[model samples]
Target: MQIATMYFKDRAQLKLQDELLQYNLNKSKGKFVGKRAEAIRELDDFEATRDAAKSIRQRVLDNLDTWLEIFEENARARGTTVLWAETPDEVNRHVLDIAARHGLKKAIKSKSMVSEESALDHAIEAAGMKVVETDLGEYILQINDYEPPSHIIAPALHKSKEEVSALFAKVHGTAPKTGIQELCAEARAVLREHYLTGDLGITGANFLIAETGSVFLVTNEGNATLCTTLPKVHVAITGIEKVVPTLEEASTLLRLLTRSATGQSITNYVDILTGIKGAGEFHGAEHMYVILVDSGRSKVLASEVKEALRCIRCGACMNHCPVYQNIGGHSYGWVYPGPIGSVITPMFIGQEVAADLPNASTLCGSCASVCPVRIPLPELLRKHRETQVRLDLRPVGERLGLRLWTWLASRPALYAWATRLGVRVMKWLGGYEGRIHSLPLASGWTNGRDLPAPAGKTFRELYAARRRAGRQT
Candidate 1:
């Protein structure tokens, strides 16, 4: 789904009015945040492990091209077809070409944000094949006519249980079950046939191991395992940053992924695939293809914010962000959202297209605190702002005002006098209530809350007054 045409300010204001959406966002993030904290507290060495994960990811990025070639060669040795795509158009074309050559009609898919970024499902459907999301959360979003995934790990975290029930009933022509188990069963029954008979199965890789030529898939649901084995041909899609030098390093990152994502020490399933079925394999796909999509990732790795690549898709940062908690994910208007999305959207896409995204934070550092990779998200966002200023992308009035403030801040005596004078002006505008209900250039900030009036005196004035009192005493 496309982002709303309204600017970020208007979009966020409108989203805050949606009581249902707010309820879902709060409830979902609260659960994730609480669980993540507990899981981390239980593990004494999570921070040390995070350091190891960071070091491993850094090493991979240091020689990304070398490791990628190593992975491709090893994967080829095991009879896997590896395709390197430099752009979204190239990636989609490659997948469609494979589908058309094989004459595949239907496919079962697990959740893949990389696929979402490439708009792969839309491309496949445009090519005239039925594609179904087997993961229950993704299944909900797909059937809802591509309602954007609101959360990274929990796509349907923005929808209430009742909402899911109603949506399923409407789409599947069956009564919605009240219980979670029954609900899953209902979805399972509906998707089982498609999983068994689809011409191809598509999934995403969590980590590509170069040493073993294996792609790892981690999920709570068993659907990924099915997608890896059920169909005659299986396709695994992931970003170029997913490759690591060895399996042991991949394992270390896996420990952090689940704990930071869902609060569990480990997820329900972890599947490692070396290649297609061999001569005597009883259960496996006959052919396997792994697509490494560079769609803006190569550029990201080369930029100042290369550390963003250390992200394991854990979703911890999003879960703790106050801004994301209030406005939800769709407001970001892209495949990724929250803190990481804010950083990457401008870099991957144009800074002008998602210009306001970097400004959508409180700079509270909640995201950084929760991040397992030690990325300085607030600093990266500040850099984006600096780039915007350098490009003169901000409004002319905003630029002039900032310049004036900078000039005033440089002179100490003038600054003290100006702040005191500003306090008087503010007190006049704010009235005896001591709160500003409205203000120039910031109506949005005070729309639902009040800004406190400035103190009557600046710190320098207060200190001077105290000094005079002490001398008289």
Candidate 2:
């Protein structure tokens, strides 16, 4: 089965997701708490910064058309070729066209969620080019022979350090060790070789600056620089939402992004690579191509759900979300997960395919509170659910139950009768304990929960009793 299909349809994916969630809860025990506290402490003006970033993003979105045009003009002036792709197929063809033109055999890749979304690796490999993932996380995932990334910031956050060591040991023929320094050294040595031998480099931009037409890439390791500098051809794949109005605005967003994400005042490296440094510099991607993919951003921009595009992919919502902290990213089974995933996945894959994603959230408003852009994620998720219900995507049993509830709620007599019946049933089932240990229709819930018996008197009865007592007094 296709990865998309397997992700959406297979029950094992859900089960695996559950297992992975439990695993993460255990692994992130102390580190997660520490990071969260650090985030709160490090950013003294978090709210102000977040507000500033939100205001800047809103202004950029309002003038996206103007900014994009300005960005294109600047990028071209910088001696870089820019390509626009309306669809994933177009994007694949464009990249493959470039590869064929250059007779590219091997391509080195930095971590790119856009490329993952477009399935670029598969396309390049099919076009007779070998693509190597250079980021330590990406390389480990690639070698373990697995699926695309689950998290936006930390692609392999689901996998523990030990799991990574095992993957390295398996791919490099060494015994898995628990030492992170040794494992990182091994990965660096292996990825350096790929970087030195690569013919083309592909990367994703954290932000595309309209003022300077510069792509800002933030990374913990220097892999992004290596990817762009080593190969003779550099290709950047990114969504249209990545565009910002100015370098200053992008930097402001970056300040909040890294801090909210991992509580770092700054990332390990922040580089702004313009066009070729020199005419004869055969080192970098001799021809730098930036593929701005619209895939569905234009439609998103035109809809009420457009606020979702405001996301900067910081993963703060996921880190703070009670649901995400419990279930992790894999459960959603998409490129983006957590609350943002719930709101946008359906739009990307269609409502029918991602119907369950919206229901995944608890609507506790935690996502909205933590969102740096204030995307109103819970509201958007509620909207997805309402849309699903309108389209009859709800299960028959659930729909029928809701209809039955509505019908009873509309008729006071019928509602009272049902309440009395429910009270009698519960009282009989509970005996002297006043709690039902098992229920026929809800045995799963009752298996671990005790249902308290209803009060002998209804609300109306209690009210009448109170009135009589007052009159007697």
Most accurate candidate by TM-score: 1
Query: Least accurate stretch of 10 residues (summed lDDT) in model 2?
Result: 1-10
For 1-473, candidate 1 gives per-residue lDDT tens digits of 35442267777877899999999998987799899888888777888988998899989999999999999999999989999899878878888888887888888998899888778888889888889999889999999998889888999988998998899899999987687787888889989988878878899999999987898999998999998898888899999999988988888888888989999989999999998899988777788899999989998998878889988899999999999899988888887889999998887777888889888788899999888888889988888899899988888988999999999999888998988998888877778898899876798678778999876777788999999999999
Model 2 per-residue lDDT tens digits across residues 385-440: 88888999999988999999999999998898788787888888888989889997
> What are the Cα lDDT values of the candidates?
0.88, 0.80
Q: RMSD of model 2, in Å?
A: 2.5
Q: Over the full model, what C-alpha lDDT does candidate 2 score relative to the true structure?
A: 0.80
TM-score of 1: 0.96
lDDT of 1 at 9: 70
RMSD (Cα, Å) for all candidates, in order, is 1.7, 2.5
Q: After superposition, how far is residue 87 of candidate 1 from its true place, in Å?
A: 0.9
Query: Which regions of candidate 2 fall more than 4 Å away from where they truly are?
Result: 1-21, 29-33, 279-284
Distance from true position, residue 445, model 1, in Å? 3.2
